[model samples]
Target: MSTLDALQAALAEEHATLWTYGVLGARTSQSASPALYDAVTAAYRRHRARRDQLRLLVRDAGGEPVAAAVAYELDGALVRPPQVQRAAVGLEAAGVETLLALVARSSGEVRDWALTEATWSAVWQLELGGAAQTWPGAPELD
Candidate 1:
């Protein structure tokens, strides 16, 4: 795929991730889990920043960015701590996939940026109770 396509995919993932984190934050807040709440809040901010970056990248490449969906279909209700953690893991894993695709199709500064985002997603996946994979982003290789 082209760089613009990869960037659009990443932006779509960011949009979904932002929505997932919103649900996570709400559930964590309701559970009174201060630590989880903080983590979710931080993740939400990171995804938002990444989303904005992806939009800029698309625009710089002379392409219009894709708009976010009105709503995303989550796996299930994230009403408890364990569920919230699981949702986080899934979100981060999905992010890793998206960023890895972006990295493969991008170059120079864009590739570097995608790599950084993928690394962050991998770290977040581990933090959210995912096992450390031999290849964090390229799970198909593993």
Candidate 2:
């Protein structure tokens, strides 16, 4: 895929992650857990920032950035702590995949950015559970 294509895909993933984090924050806020609520809020902010950056990158590359979907279908209700954590894990997993694609097809600053994002996603995954891979954004071998 081209750099534009990778940027577009990363933008889409960021949009989805933004929406997913909204759900996570809402559900965790209900429990009155300050820590989880703060984490979700931070993640939401990060995704939003990344989304905007991606749009700029796409435009600089002479391509129109894709818009976010009207709504995203989540795995399930995030009423409980475990449910919210699982949602976060799922979002990070998706991010890792998107960033991996970007890393593979991008160069210079874009490649560095993708690698950083993937590393952050991996850290988030580890925080959510014991989910850590040798290569965070790499596809698993059969």
Candidate 3:
């Protein structure tokens, strides 16, 4: 896909991710545990920053950014803290894969910046769980 088109797709993934995090955060209960709750909150904040960046970038590209829905269709019924982290980890893994695909077509600064984002965010994710591959598209074309 074209860089702008790729960016739009990435933005859409971010929209879903942002929405998922919101529900996941709110759903975290007293039983969800403090550690998982804190981690989930931090994850959402990071994702939100990236999501907003893409939103503005969409404006630069003369396209409207996708609106994040109030909620996403989650895979299963809500569970406890450990399960919440598992869900959060899965979401980030999927998002990393999508972002990796989007960044594949970009070059120079955009490519480097995209890789940096993916790498760092993946690192954040790994902090909560284990190491997971973010970039199936690497060694990136750009």
- List TM-score per model, in order: 0.94, 0.91, 0.83
lDDT of 3 by residue, 44-107 (tens): 9988898888888777778877776666798786666666777887777677676777678777
Model 1 lDDT-worst window of ten: 29-38
Tens digits of per-residue lDDT, candidate 1, 25-48, equal 877873577767777788889899
- Go through the candidates in order and give the clash count of each: 0, 0, 0
Off by over 4 Å in 3: 30-32, 131-142
- Minimal lDDT window, size 10, model 2: 133-142
- Alpha-carbon RMSD of each model: 1.3, 1.7, 3.5
**TM-score, ranked from best to worst:** 1, 2, 3
Per-residue alpha-carbon lDDT of candidate 2 for residues 1-142, written as tens digits (9 for 90 to 100): 8999999989988998998898788778635777677777777887888889899989988999999999999887778887898788888888988988998998999899888988888787886773767766665841
Q: Which whole-number lDDT from 0 to 100 does residue 17 have in model 1? A: 88
Residue-level lDDT for 105 in candidate 1: 92
Residue pairs in clash, model 2: none
Error of 1 at 133 (Å): 1.3
